[model samples]
Each structure stands twice: as C-alpha cells, then as structure tokens.
Target: MALFEQIRVRLPRGARADAALAGGVFVLVAFPEGKLLGHGGDPLPSRVVSWLLVIVVCGALLFRRRYPVAVGWFTVVGTGAYYVLSDVDGPLVLVPIVALYAIAAQGRMQAAIAMAAAMVIGVGAATLTTASDVTGTAVFMLTGWLVAVVALGSGRHGRLAYAEEEARLRATEERLRIARELHDVIGHNISMINVQSGAALHRLKKDPAQAEAALSAIKAGSRDTLQELRATLDVLRRVDEDAPRAPTPGLARVDTLVGSANLAGLAVRIERTGAERALPARVDLAAYRIVQESLTNVARHSGAGHVTIRLAYGDRELTVAVEDDGRMTARPARPGGGSGIAGMTERARALGGELAAGPRPEGGFVVRARLPYGITGERWSGAADDQGPAGG
Candidate 1:
C-alpha cells in the first residue's frame, strides 16, 4: 500500500493520466490477444514483424497530447495493416478507441469523427470475407466505443472552454476595479491642486500671503496624492521592490480627508452617529473612498458653501453619506462615465452592498452608501440623510 501510495502521488491529473493508465492495460492485453488467436490452421504469427507492429502502436499513444490527430491516425491505420497481414487478433480495437478519445478531448471533433469512419471502412476491407461474423462483431463494438469517446471528449472540451472564459471575465472585472480606484485617488486630488494653483496665480500681487497659502495647500495636496497613488500602483508591480509600503487609509482617516477638502476651499462638518468600530479591510477602504469621492465631487462640481460628511454605524451595515447644499455643476470629465457615481456603485456592489447618488428634490445633491459590517450601529438604522440642507 505504501508503494502504491507513492506511485499515486506522482500521477498526472485528467485525460493524460487516463490515457497513460489505459495504454498500459492495452499493451498487457495485447500479448494474451495474440496468443488466443494462435490456434489450429489460423495460428498467430510469432514473426519479429508481428511484435514490432504491436509495440509501434502502443508506443505511439504516449505522445497523444502533443500530436493527437497524427497519433490517432497512425494507431488506426497501423491496426488495419497488422490485421490484414498477420491474420491474428490484436489489441487494435483498444488502440483506436483510446486514440479517438484523446483526439476528441483535445477539441478535435472533426478529426475524431473522420478517424471513426476510416476505422469502419478499414475493418470491412480487411476482415469482412476472411473473418465473417467476427468482423461484424468487432465493428459493432468499435462503433459504440467511438460514439462514447466522442460524447465524453466533447463534454470535456466544453468545460475547458467555459473555465477559460470565466477566468478572462474575472481578469477584466479586476482591471476595471483598479482603474476606478486610480481615478478616485488621483483625479480628485489633482483637480484640487489645479484649482488652488489657479487661485494663487490670480491673487499673487493683491495678497501675497493668501497666494502663499494656496501654494502651500497645493504642495501638501500633491504630496498626499502621490503617496496614495504609490499605494495604488503597487498592485501593478511585477517584481519585488525595496520601497517602503504604507497602510491603506480606511474609515479612521476621514478626519484627514475632511481637513484636505477644507483646505481645498470647501467648508465641511462631520457627523458620527454611533460608537465607532473596526471594519473589514475592504469595507473600511470602501467607506473611506466613498466619502473621499463624494467630497471630491462637491469641491469640483457643487458650489455649496458648506458640506456634511456623515458616518452611521448599524448592526449589520455601515452607512457613509456625504451631502452638500451647493448647486450641481455640469457633469465633469470621468473616463468610465457618470462622474464617479458609477465607479462608487461598482465598489459597493462588489461587497454585497448598494450605493445611491442623485440630487435631492429640495436642492443639493447626495451620495449615500450602505455596506454590510454585521456589527455596529442600531439594528435597523438606514443611511442618515441631511437633517435639512447641509450646513446652509
């Protein structure tokens, strides 16, 4: 049992292993088949040619994967030739059956069917009159075996195709998610710097100190943007690097985010409605991002004087809401469209949550996201809306 276990550990998986194991059985069975046919006036030949042909057919099957069609045809044609010349039963049936199965498993349906046809015709031409009923019985078995192999092979081929397609789809979705993260991280901060720089340039002569302040803000914003950008791009690295890494910002850093927006010239107030708790890394990151992106939209598009950032913890969900009383500016330039709303939606959906963003009927726009936490806040609390117009 130990020896068998050791051998089993080295076995290859799937169809290749199946072919190898079946090939061994066929080779061993060949000797008995030849001996059984060697009787009376129609004795099997003991010539060197007979053994060589059997070995050739068996050996050819080893390379079935690399050259499936060629190996299949060789085995089928070799079996026919051996029968015609030797007049003795051979393990030719197993050889062709195994070859056809390998061919179909390799997604060569046309070649497998063609090989089956050739085998039928070859058997008729070689054995019909000389062997009579034995020929019909062998052909009947071969016909049924070929049909089974084709069915099995076709199923295997389809499963592999589906698995490949699933892998490709997952990769595409990951790329889209990363793109959205980069856009939210870089786009908002860069846009803020652009606005600050323009303000500094306009106020340089009139208020040197104010211009200096704006420049200082731009410098600080640019630095933080680069740091977060580094963290985001770390995922794209193909080789190990020696650079230091930083922890990803989460709900813990919303204070710093609000401070940054305040510097970007948006007056803001934060509301924490429940006892704070640690969140799963992904949920935490998503929460921070939704807030950051909401404020970014306010800075770029909402002309409201004041904004509110609200974090409401719930028993099974955490809600992050950002609202402003500012007028909604025209849609900004977003690469994947819908002005960062779609990107935020994707993030929430990925985590089995949902997000909603639209203008409130009374006035200002709102962005609210609800993410599952399974621990936090009130049992049935929903995302908090602005009590009235935020900080009006």
Candidate 2:
C-alpha cells in the first residue's frame, strides 16, 4: 500500500489524471465489451466496430473538464452507436455518466440535466424496438445513478465556490487591517513632527536653545515613526524570521502617545479607574489604536490645549475615552476626512466592542470606545455621523 501511494504521489495532477482515467475506463469497457459481444454470437467485424466505438467514447473523457458538455454529447452518441451495432450490454455506458458529472462539476447544471434526460429517454425508447432485455427496473436504476453523480458534482461546485468567496473576504479584511495599522502608526508621529518642525522654525532666530529642543523632538519622533513603520511592514513579510522585532503597540505604550502629544503642545493627562489587569492581545491593540488615533486627530484638527486620556477597566469590559478642550472649526469636508474615526470604530467592533466619536455635550470633542472580554457581540449601529470636528 505504501509503495502504491508513493507511485500515486509521483503522478502529475490535472490533465495527467484525466489521461489515466481514460486509459483505465478503456481497459475496463473494451475488454469486457469484446468478450460479451463474442459470446453473444457477434461476428469479428461487428466486434471490431464495437471496440472502436468503445475507444472513442472512453477517449472523449480526456477533455471532460475542458469541454464537459461537448465531451458528454460525444460519449452519449458514441454509446448509442455502440448499442445499435452490438446486441450485448457493456460497461461503456459509465463513460457518459462520468462526463455528466464533469459537466455538473463545472457549474453547468442545465446541460447536465438535459443530457441525463436525453440518455434516459433514449434508453427507454431503445428498449421498445431493440431485442435487448433492458427492463423498467434497469432504467430506474440508471436514473438513480445519474442523479447521484450530478448531485455529487453540484455539491463539489458549491463547496469550491464558497471556499473561494471566503478566501477573498479574508484577503480584503487583511488589507483593511494593514491599511489601518499604517495610518495609525504614521499619522500620529507625522503630526507631531509637523508641529515640532514649525516650532523649531518659529524659534530658530529668537531662542536658539528652544529651537534646538524642538529639532531634537522632531528627530525623536521621526526615529519612533521609522521603527514602528518597520515593525508594521515586518508583519507583511511574514517569511522573514530574522527581521528586527519590536513589541506590538498596546495599552502598555499609552505613555509614549502622551509624551508625543505633549511635544505637539497639547497638555495631556491619563486617568485610570477600576482594577487594572492584563488584557487580551486584540483588546490591548484596539485600545491603543483608539488612543493613538484620538491624539492624532486632536493634534491635526482640534485646536485643543488640553487633552484627557481615560481608561476604565470594568468586570467584563474596558472603556477608553479621549476628550480635548479644543475649538470647533467648520472645516470643509474632504475625501477620507473621517477615516481615523471609522478605522478606530472598526477595530473596536472587530473584537466584539463598540466605539463612539462625537462632540462632547458641553464643549470639546470626545472619542470613546468599549472593548469586551469575549470576542463576540451584536454589531452596533454606529455610523460616520458619529465623527466629530476632530475627525482626521
């Protein structure tokens, strides 16, 4: 058995498999058909014609996948010719059944049904005029076999279609995830660098020391951005084992965001309530991205001088909120204006959580999110309207 398996494994797939199938079917049908015809008093000339017809029917199977309906009709016609010329029942009928299966597997159910009907009717009609012993039971049994073959092929087609769709969805989700990660990683640092560079230029002439400090902050922010960028890109090159690895950003790195926000001239404060404990990786990352994107929006759009970052750990969930005492501006809407809020909300919801981003009732803008412990929940009806003035 093991040696047989080794030989099977070495056999090429696809067309080669079809060729082997045709050869096997020819051997099974041609040999038995010749003996049956000879035993039934068929002359040598008639037997030779019967063998050639069998060869033609079996050989048509080689192109079953490429031209399933065409091959099916050819085999059906060839089988009918074989029956008309010879008086013996033979296994050549199985070839057209195989062709029917191939047609159904190619998602041609209409053609398969039509061919099956034709064959059944043809056989029934042949039994009336021919001297053969085909009975009603035999015709019914053939119908059952044909139905089973078509059903199996159709089932295989459905399964393959479903799997392909699932693969496409997974690919789309992965792309969106990567895009969100890149945006969060680069947007915050770039905002900080932009502010720091402006500060450095403004102070370059007056206070050289302050300008030097601003330049140093820009350098630090640039370095952090590059490192984070590398880490994010490393995930895409999953084949590289020796790539420089950095810890994935999570709630543990909230302080880094606070520091960057401070460098951008926003006085940032972090407040935590309830019991603090380790969180699932997905929750940790989602919370971190929410905070990071909030700070980015504040720096870019909100003219807020003070921002508060809040984290409240509950019994079953974690709440992350960022509020800023910033002025609201009637900024003209642009393409991709609120992508940050959308991404943050998607991240929260993907982990069975919810997020809300809108203006605080009293004044400034606020972005809040709730992440659950379990990774399953009903979807929230949060929309893009939840995006506030600070939306990036």
Q: Model-by-model lDDT, in order?
A: 0.73, 0.79
Candidate 2 weakest ten by summed lDDT: 383-392
TM-score of 2: 0.88
Tens-digit lDDT string for candidate 1 (274-368): 87888876678778778878888887777777898888988778898888998873336564464488777766766678899888787888898
Cα deviation at 78, candidate 2, in Å, is: 0.9
Q: Give per-residue lDDT, candidate 2, residue 271.
A: 97
Summarize candidate 2's per-residue lDDT along 1-392 as a digit string, tens digits.
99888788576579998999899889888788767875857777777887788878999989886887899999999999988885566888989988888888878999999999999999999888776689889999998999999999899989989999987976776666666766777777887899879878998999898888889889998887777676666556765255334455678978888887777778999999999999876677778879988888888788899999999999999999999988863222324554678788787887778898888877889998999977785432221111111111
Task: Please estimate how well model 2 matches the true structure, expressed as its whole-model Cα lDDT.
Answer: 0.79
Q: Name model 1 segments beyond 4 Å from true.
A: 1-67, 92-94, 117-128, 132-152, 238-246, 333-339, 374-392
The TM-score leader among the candidates is 2
Which ranges of candidate 2 are over 4 A from the true structure? 1-11, 37-41, 239-246, 329-338, 378-392
Would you list the clashing residue pairs of candidate 1? 38-44, 304-326, 313-377, 314-376
Worst 10 residues of 1 by lDDT: 383-392
